[model samples]
Target: MVALRGRVWDSGVMQNGALSELFGRMADVMEILAEDRFRVNTYRKVARIIADTPVDIGELLESGRLAEVPGIGKSSLAKIEQFVHTGRIEAHEALLRRIPAGLLELLRIPSMGPKSVKAVYEALGVTGMADLKAALESGAVAELPGFGRKKTDQLLKGIAFLEKATGRIRLDQAAEAAQIVGAFLAEIGQVKAIVPAGSLRRRCETIGDVDILVTVDEADVPRDEGRRTMDERRGAAGMGTGRMPVLRAGETLATHKGRTPSAQEAVIEAFTAAPFVDEVLASGPTKGSARIRTVEALVQVDVRVVAAGSFGAACQYFTGSKAHNVALRELAVKAGLKLNEYGLFDGEKPVAAAEEADIYKALGLDYIDPRLREDRGEIEAARNHTLPAPVSLKDIRGDLHMHTTASDGEDAIEEMAQAARRLGYRFICITDHSQSSAIANGLSARRLARQVKAIRTLNEKSRDLTILAGVELDILADGRLDFDDAVLADLDYVTASIHSGMAGDREKLTTRMLKAMDSRYVNCISHPTGRLINERGAMDLDMEQVVRHAARTHTALEVNANPWRLDLKDTHCRMAVEAGAMLAIGTDAHSAAGLTLMAYGVDTAARGWATKKDLLNGMTVRQLQVFVNKKR
Candidate 1:
């Protein structure tokens, strides 16, 4: 499918994400046109499959492993093959032609679905945001058959939110885009190294764009035997052996021999020419930039070709929080040195140009990790030689919250346990929703009792892992939990949350949360702020008070790992830990695949400078039991 912007790959190279996007875009367009519901759903499902597939589509196709995936029949296989070979889906192009391209933009509005967009289009001739805004302002949309005043107001609010939203995308989206673009660039035989720079390297929750620094193996015609060997391997593997025409060891590099592009130019060409790229923003001998299409978003990726000697310097300069860089430069100025993307120099005599640690050591400071380079007290700590080690995924001993088929989860309890065990987790808690959360197929008291027995029975049979019975009990607006304390007494863990009545004022919401924490059975709070990134704003709770109350009550606050809701966000995580409250990292996984989301939570915790001591996920099973038992 062709978007208004992005180039289709003519190189015949394809990634799973690109194929997923094509099918997803087709599904979206078909929905807008009110195409066959079954076909639309089928396309959407396949899109998800492609996006979630562990291997690249090209690799899968080459290995003939496509048939292993259920639901992909001959027609779907044909489309996948067609897109792989020709970079276009004929049916997708036909559907795009049937609708105004701007209609797709309308679907991006929060709460705006295809049906709503179709209604507005049919009734008020709304083709895009500008047209829709006019119709809403004139009360024409409110008067539509199904849209009343409330719906119109929501649409207007959504539009305002969309307008206010930053162009930056979530961290996962940027990372995925970087992987796809980086892979494409790596295909070039001359490309030697690719390192992600900027906010992406810093592990920020969102990224404005992707910046990558690269080094190409440059050599003269009597090419080094190693370079020749690599080229031979590339050719043997069916990848073309294309070499750049110039070579240099230091800063004075590129000397063009005829029209053949230099090594840097070749890399830039391949980068901007990738099929996943939507638009080429800029191209040069040393740098190239383009907006690339990933399954999740259209992300702009910039690539800079630098000498191997300057690669580290380039990384430090580009992988920056401007404030941190400014602080480092000030130190450089005071020390009679100069620092830039080229190198850290003492009066133009290169002092440190190689590794990041070398630059820090020359400046008389410890190397600050990219995650700690946010200019948030890390610089001072690094200088003082007191930087605390940040928490890592390996430190997580267990996932404290999850669900199973007894609730809304996709997998059975045993299956969920096996997935956690495979990750080397010592323990996991099955925190299914309480009865009040009817929409989630929440379990009743009797059901919970039965689940608790099933978990105990399972735990008895297992020696390597422990499964704890838990409930994500709802906190009513009036400050009572979905279940009484008597019901909670039967469970090994309890996480209280406000799922409904979140519209209450700050004082009211804060009071309800505090009251819930008062329960001895409550050991943690899940998705503490209830914020769905980009879609919903955080609930207005006085988090300062909540943190203090949690610390006092010994209730750990959760840093939910779900990308959409990294609730108890980085900032909140810092605040909570500073206030003496512990954090619990949980994928809040509904499916076995969801268990991997813990990486996002761990990164967020690290960004906040959390150590293993401040997170309950790092606690041993026995220690965790002691913790919850102490609450009782």
Candidate 2:
């Protein structure tokens, strides 16, 4: 099947989440109908497993590994298989056939479950949310034996809370919220380390909620050990002094084989009452949940406190794309050890947990970066010690695509060069727009030539930077370059791109890009797919064919660093690398300020699993010149 840019892969994740919901519904229905308790519990447990798993169930079944997966037995397997093949599970269908679908939805209400749902349904015929609200208003639900006025009022509050929390936010929005919350908590001296977890940590495109893991150093909390009374000492050699002056109230959530009140508890308490927090779902010493309201959205943030010793284990556990962690746990099992958030255990002895690398090392695997923790063959790669050490933001030597005042860019060429030099870059390409890009103040052949001479003069004056004369040539609808070859040939680098004709016919689009890639004057293709995230959807092209053609030619592909246009995304980066094609990460900077966006491109490249070996910007100026000069 032809893979779609925003389809199957993302849809698979959603499918898994939906299955979790569906399975839980099945369990709730069976329980209410008074089905077998064992089967009900089995379904409930499996729902959690399915929900946590990163890979799609259908994909697992296709691989014939469904049977071997934990929490999936013959009965559950049949249900899943039936759902995959026929689009519906008979067991689920049977249960739905018996109960009003509305009652199952009622279980979604805060603190409401099978017993309460059954009671409400029987007493007031309140089968759905609307019915339940009506019953409450009529005083019918309040009259139920176990549910008093307070419970009814709370349920109303829960309904409103659930409604607000129902829809998910985009990954970018969640990221902003997490950063704000993290910065706020970092002020507290007790917080040793704080990092994002859940889908946000995994860098999933869309996030259900943001989970943050906080490690509290014991030294940060106050301890009162000096002169405990005899009776007080007798109560316990006791936990460490959990002196937290940060919050109004703090309590221990949980503790492992360590001593002292968990430092994690204080963090939980402070986080719950943090100024940004809008609601606290669950709060304890080890883990805290709250909704942090950013200017644009309310994002749920989970803070898990960990001791110093188990820091690595807990980080790995909570930073999970569950599918990735499940793979790691299986590896631990095979090695005759158990891995959990607390630490990896060899029977009664603790093995590795102090550091994330140590935990992976103990498993005989290389440390897998959190971004690559999607169980997409990363485990096998790690086992063989072949995991790609992706190119970091620091490794970038220069940018290849940028514009200046000659185009519609805000900065002058000299100013842009100064900005790049300040970034310690060895070189930069002034890729101003060509004649066809009138909207961007496209430079004519005369203007471009003047710009080139000015750059050459700047190069002579500059001690630390080399400026390359370049043009971002637009490929016309008919596969013709904006400027003739004579003009392109004069430039040090020629980067072709699609600004118009983005929605052209598929085959024509692929051909148009291929024709540009085939040009001797073109050193690279910019933002190969022409996607403007959250604005313009990616264009249609046979990416496989395009990537193959790029490899055949020596032309590199540009991973546009602009957050708005992170084209040649993580998958394409990997595709280019595996095909032995070089890649360039360019900020596509229009102004000096846009140069900082290089990190965003690097992040996208990391997600694609691209390493220095796969990128052109990782090269020194001389080395990069050799590759850029190839098409000529």
Report the lDDT tens digits of candidate 2 across residue range 151-185: 99878866765555537665556766676566555
| Cα-lDDT of candidate 1 | 0.81
Runs off by more than 4 Å, candidate 2: 1-172, 203-206, 223-263, 278-281
Clashes of each: 1, 5
* Candidate 2 Cα deviation (angstroms), residue 172: 4.9
- Give the CA lDDT, 0 to 100, for residue 410 in model 2: 71
Off by over 4 Å in 1: 1-25, 47-62, 78-97, 143-146, 220-258
lDDT of 1 by residue, 53-167 (tens): 5445767777889977797878998888766643446677678789997898888787688889989988789999999999999999998888899989989987877777777
Candidate 2 lDDT (Cα, 0 to 1):
0.76
